[model samples]
Target: MVAKYVMLADTTRCINCKACEVACRAEWDTPLGYSRDWVKEVESVNAKGMPELQIFPGRCQHCDDAPCVEVCPTGASWKREDGIVLVDHDICSGCELCVPACPYDARWLNPVTNTISKCTFCQPRIDKGLQPACVETCVGNALIFGDANDPNSEVSILLKTKEWQRLITDEVNIGPNHYYYTAGKTIPVEVMPKLHERHLAGKSIESIVNPLGTIGIGGMMAVFLGAGVKKLVDRRKEVSEKEDNHEHH
Candidate 1:
């Protein structure tokens, strides 16, 4: 089996310090009012019957079946061979079709570049044999990244031994690669991904644009076929009438 990269998040050990967020910003120099990654702080009662802050470090799920790649008409949004979902700046059209398609709210249009931007798993750093910035700066060492397919990798062993859970809902389970280890604790309901109303433009492309194109092509083929059959039938009938006239004569 090929190596599939995955990020294992030990939510129980997360300190909610936002170190990962800072590290990501610094590494990418992300613009103002947008971020590539985030730490979700959900205030709720913990297992101890006391109000506790639940932290979930979130980013692009790098799903095995990603919706962003599906809605992108330009084919700019694509997943890498190792499971990292990324957007190509040159091919992106700033149409924002991918924005609403993402259930995790991971994609956004860059205000500066006018292109789609999202977490790349720090692909450049990974290519250079270094870890992602967020994983490197995690204060609690909660974030673990490696090839899950490798038997010798730490993530592979942890996944085998630990009871890990994915943030998947019944309605929209796209096979996200991120894993969460709650350490016998229940996750807060607030942080779960909710169903988003798709944007009008994106909706039309799927519902109107594609179906219309198919219908148009099919309709044209049907018209030409009907005309050809009619002409052939007329020609045969005309020849039959001439043969009858000759016999009568």
Candidate 2:
């Protein structure tokens, strides 16, 4: 039996204390600039004349078909067999390609390792048959972690019973494991970090210019091949003309 882990977020129950964020950073010793996990505050406007704010904690989705893994040049980003997304710090080239490839704004570069880092789903505790530190420490019990692959698992059962929405775009279709449930107004896209913009538009000058090179080389090859065939045909025509001249002479 393969072991699997899933993260279930009940935004309705979330108090936005940032306990998960603190616990994750403490356990992993994550640097200042990089965060292995964090909470997002999803606020609603006072349009309904209600004086209140709704909070939503956000973290790595650990999508099944992760774009980070697909775009990583060094193969540093990889999804675990159990479904958690992680980075191989040793193999990471600190290229920042994976950083912007993620739609959830999960990936970040750790100053210490200078490699892409994101949530691991707390693999170490799961190995010891324990829930993730964040899950265990969650005061409101808003965060739930279990094997989503199993229908009987807590997360799977909650997902079926609760109203949930995955924060993602239609094109990527990563099959996000993280589920955020809320009855309040949905968060605006402007508030969320735009992680895919760089990757979609080609982040660096190198990433953009290299593809043009491939197109240029292919075009040049086609032109050269066409010119070679034309020269061959002209030579054949010249030989025939000379032979006819000799015959007529």
Best by lDDT: 1
Candidate 2 off by > 4 Å:
1-4, 170-173, 184-195, 199-249
Best by TM-score, which number?
1
Total clashing pairs for each candidate:
0, 1
Residue pairs clashing, model 1: none
Cα lDDT of model 2 by residue, 1-249, tens digit: 675676877877888888888888888898875667777654455777766566767778888878788878778888888988888888998888777778888878778878777888888888888888889989999999898778898888988887777766655556888777776457555434354645553455447667788889999999999999999999999999999999999
* Per-model CA lDDT versus the true structure: 0.89, 0.78
lDDT of 2 at 216: 93
